[model samples]
Target: MDPVARQTLLAAMDAGWADPRRLYAEASTARRLLDQAREVLAQGLGVRPSEVAFAPDGPTAVRWAMEGLLHAARRRGARTVASAVEHSAVLAPGRHRATTAGDPSLFVEVPVQPSGALDLPAWNAALQVPGTVAAALQQANGEVGTMQPLEDAWDACRRAGVPLVVDAQACLGRTGAPTSYDVLAGDAQSWAGPGGLGILVVPEGTRWALPGPPDPDGALSGPTRHTPWVPLALAAAEAWQQTGATLDADAREATALVDALRAAAAALPDTEVVGDPVDRLPHIVTFSALYADGEAIVREFDRRGFAVASGSACTASTLEPSHVLAAMGALTHGNVRVTLPLLRVAGGRSEDVARFAEAIPAVVAAVRAEVGAPRW
Candidate 1:
């Protein structure tokens, strides 16, 4: 998180630690701060403050938005469509809904290009299905850094009379939020703010409903309806405001680093850089090594003083290969996902990027040799 955001949170934690739903003085102050945060988020998203709903985090907000849209669409039919490359949070609801509806295919998965681009044609076709109600296509992918054709996807959903929920967690502060989405979801932590703050934008008159019973005002209610913590929300707004002010320069610098990393990864033996080389996120890059394990590679890098993530089972309980890698038909093993900070305030620096790049090939090769993996 940005230092400013961090300090703001620390300060808020001290002063705004009251129940915002209550009518006390402390609660009133907390409510005002929370409202101010919501206003900032709404302005950034080009929506009204009334349209924004705060959740515990991004995934929860996504679940709420998805369930709401899907439930609202039940009148038309209980079917929805999404890109195969969507985050698990976006896919989980449809799967759960499908299970409850007694049909495994209640959710249709649209194929994506090897470059990680969404298959607009397939998405449109899925929308034409008799029971289709809402569709989900992420603004940009978190794993592969691929930017989806959102305008085109939104157009298709519009033509089919289906509401589109865009998971904008990856693109909100990095590239600015897209203006075309009917329902937008994002996370505070993604923009150098504290976690536990999820941003949900529900445009006025959007065809969406909560999965459960309605509240006193006829608004949809979920399992939890308590307002978010005042400080976290305020810090998120402050961080987002800062990100917006410096995004252009930060993006250029981060993109240069990513470009360099991409070139280095592509040049490495038995390695393939995944996602679009040019049309990807400015701060994230992923690559896979042949004949090596992703966890092994991540460990090797960590030992060498660089923190990186892998596409393979990150923990002992989850041994499944990344669905995102599988969707792109890329090597799932020996995968490394590197995400750099977007600004100096967030510890983003060219020196760190250079250090990581310089250490990559050696660490990867060392891991490969330890595993007795063959080089291509």
Candidate 2:
């Protein structure tokens, strides 16, 4: 999170510490802030405040969206369809639902291109399947920074008479939300807001419903049990506000940084840049270095004061390849994922990229040498 937004959240906590569901004066104040936060996010996303619902976090929002839409679709004897590259949050619920229901075929997983973009033909074909009830596809992949074809996916779902849930967790405040979407899920943390807050948009007449058991009010809605934490909501709103007017500049700056990283891959032997090089999230770049283990590379970067991440299973004790990288047909070993801070992007700076470009080659070389692997 950025310093300004961090302070905003701290200030909100001071004022919104009270329960917003109550009727007391203090509660009323909290309620107002909560509603204002919701309105702010709604305005940013081009939706009605009434259509916005709160989730405790992004994964919960994904689950709620998948379950609610699938349940509604099941009323029409429809099943679930999603991309094979969706985050575990989107994939897990359907697996669990199918396991409990004793039918493994309740869900259909669409394949994707090696670029991490969904195969348009496969996506459309999946939706056209007679019983496809709910279709889930992300606006972009968080791990690889690949952007999906939202408009085409939306069109296919519309033709199939299915509700499409677009997971905007990676692109929400940082990029414009797609108008073609029926349901959208976003994470506050993606926009430098408090970690636990998530936003779910169920636009009017979308036909979503909670899976089982209704609350006393005769409705099941967002993942939260009671009123959402007002402070986090306010913080999320403030963070979203901070993104205004700077989105384009940030995109340009971050894209340049990512492009620089892509260029560096050529200088570093046994390394390959992953994702759709041109059509990707601006702030993220991922690459894999052969022979070096993911965990060791991450540690080396950390020791050099560069906080980078890796998707390769080699980092974990279990040593499983990243599902995302596997789906993209990319190398899974010695992977590194770098996400630039929002401030750097907003400021139109590339000094951070220069530092990374210098550090990465040395770091990878050292790790490979230590591992007794072939060198460039």
- Which candidate has the highest lDDT of all? 1
In candidate 1, what are the lDDT values of residues 1-376, reduced to their tens digit?
Answer: 8787888889899778887767999987887788788788878877877788878898888777788787777667888899999888878777887889899878998999999999888888989988788888888899999999999999998999889999988877788688878888888878888888887888878877675555553222122353677888889998988888888888998899999999988888888999988888898999998877787787788887788887865422478888999999998888999988766464647888888889988887887888898543
List TM-score per model, in order.
0.95, 0.93
When summed lDDT is taken over every stretch of 10 residues in candidate 1, the lowest stretch is 217-226
Cα deviation of 159 in candidate 1 (Å)? 0.5
Q: Residue 312's C-alpha lDDT in candidate 1? A: 69
lDDT against the true structure, per candidate, is: 0.83, 0.82
Q: In candidate 2, what are the lDDT values of residues 232-256, reduced to their tens digit? A: 8888888888876577887787788
Q: Model 2: how large is the Cα RMSD against the reference? A: 2.3
RMSD per prediction, one decimal? 2.2, 2.3
For model 2, state the Cα shift of residue 366 in Å.
1.2
Which candidate ranks first by TM-score, i.e. highest? 1
Candidate 1: pairs in clash: 294-334
